[model samples]
Target: MSRIAFTPTRVAVLGAAVLLTAGAAGVAVASGEDVTHPGKRIGTQDAAHPAPAAKDAAAAKAKPREAAALTGSAKLFRKTTEDITFTFDAHLAARHNADPSKATGTFKFVHLEKPGGKGGWATGRIDCLLTGGKVASATGIITKTNIKEMNGSRVGFSVHDQGKKDRLGYSWAAVGGPDGTKKLTKCNSAAPFEQVKKGTGDFHVQPWKLPYPDPR
Candidate 1:
């Protein structure tokens, strides 16, 4: 057997050829374009690391917020008759971030006595829009008037249906003064009716100390 002699130049050439072939194969595998599978389709490999889920984007667009609750009581007194006091209690709820002057809820009046001894408790629903914590317009009913007719013909009158025209109803508007007062223009007028806060209860919650007992 004839012995072959090793040369540096020959060895370098051979090494370079091998490196080129290996580099080409590596490129083919990386790019998924191997010459051996020329006709066959090759699926591209995904990234080394997967991208994170986009849950934050979905969380950003949330549902609308709920309305807020406002519960409080006010002393409704008339400027003309300050001595004759009437306790006005309100249990109202407001929409989200709504103006405090605008609220809708229940209102109760206790000991609303007239100078002629014709007075009674009034319980009704109030839909009031206010301006600067002053009443803009308040419309409600005098559900029951414990006062009797002057002729003593009827002991008391009860509002059977709120929708009925015959039912006693009242409407009020703010009378712009230092005191938060409103003027009753419908169903027994009382001018310069002041509203003073007594206390506050939970917001957006109802049925708190309403439908009070007869004070007579």
Candidate 2:
């Protein structure tokens, strides 16, 4: 019998032929193996079952409730039909709820005699703040005032944010305040009566019931 010599070239040709046969059989060829331990596959975890894609960060976050509220500062500048200009400026720190407790901030109300250049003002600290929708109400204890009657009184007012022109209602202008009386309304306001002539600012109402504290 004649002996056949299998050289390195023949060995290489046989290996290529074996690979082609394995590929035809739909066999998964290992691209990499453990370097320390020869013949051990690197990725045994099912390639078909790939790790799930990372969850979308925004979609994974919980959505806020429909009743979630906000709190912040607000201001309004308006003029009445009687040629009296009123300005309200407040820096409120109320919470997301309508409760009067823990409401801390400052409030100021100023009025200018339109034709005449005379003016009076009242300034104080906020005691109460309530809001619902675009309307809001705020009250403050009068700490200082140029107007004698307003001294030691708590002022309250309501605001309606109507885009370009806002509506405002003052405590004294609500009921015309009684004549020569020390009794002043506190934490009470009327519906929006006077439209703003020119102003800038906004209020975000908290979640609450309708008929938002109109004590007029």
Candidate 3:
């Protein structure tokens, strides 16, 4: 056997080759791909360390997404300086420019002008609904009320959902113009006003890609 000489030039060349191989491996790790195996990714799911696909699927099934609709009840008001209270259940599809026939719900409003005194009360049926993002606009017709003039008149409501501290507003405050004045039109609601001091219920607001409900 011939003896191999350990020359400095040969040692340097070997070191450079090792460095090149290491650089290639670093590039593969940074790219997040397995160059040696096409169509195979290097991540939580690998050949030797297979991912738990069944477990992931089960978790997704357990926490299903909620359908986009407003179906629940809420008691709104601060009960202090702003003593007007509203309690109602709204069940309607978030349809853009939907007709009054497509909505169904009821609402009761009370205003306590004096502390611990009998206040005026009004009840109505929801006739129209419109929703976008986390906001819902609704309208109703007053069927019964202690205040004579309010009976038979239409009312508007706007809701801004924020978990348990959601905000709400009515047409008298949120809407303006020909519909808000002398005659409060149906299905017209502007931006929400920070009026609700207390809130309870669900408002699964969803975008309805259509025009506002017809005011006719």
Top candidate, metric lDDT: 3
Instruction: Give the clash count for each candidate.
Output: 2, 0, 0
In candidate 1, stretches whose alpha carbon ends up further than 4 angstroms from where it belongs are 1-71, 76-104, 112-119, 127-136, 148-216
lDDT of candidates 1 onward, in order: 0.35, 0.56, 0.64
Q: In model 2, where do residues sit more than 4 Å from their true spots?
A: 1-98, 174-186, 199-216
Model 2, 1-216: lDDT tens per residue?
136999999999999999988764453344465443457675664566443342354444644432322233333443442344333444333233444534566666555555455677667776666556677677667778777776777767677766656677767673564122335444567777766555434434453443357678
| Model 2, CA-based lDDT | 0.56
Provide the RMSD of all predictions against the true structure, rounded to 1 decimal: 29.1, 22.6, 20.3
- Pull out the clashing pairs in model 1: 69-203, 69-204
Ranked candidates, highest TM-score first? 3, 2, 1
- lDDT of model 1 at residue 34? 45
Off by over 4 Å in 3: 1-82, 93-101, 114-116, 174-182, 198-216
Q: Write the per-residue lDDT of candidate 3 for residues 1-216, one digit (tens) a residue.
A: 136997999999999999999998898898887667656677646556455776688788886342233444455555454355666555554342344446777877676765457767788888777667777787788888877767788887777777767777777762331131336666775566644554445434544455446788
The candidate, 1 or 3, that scores higher on lDDT is 3
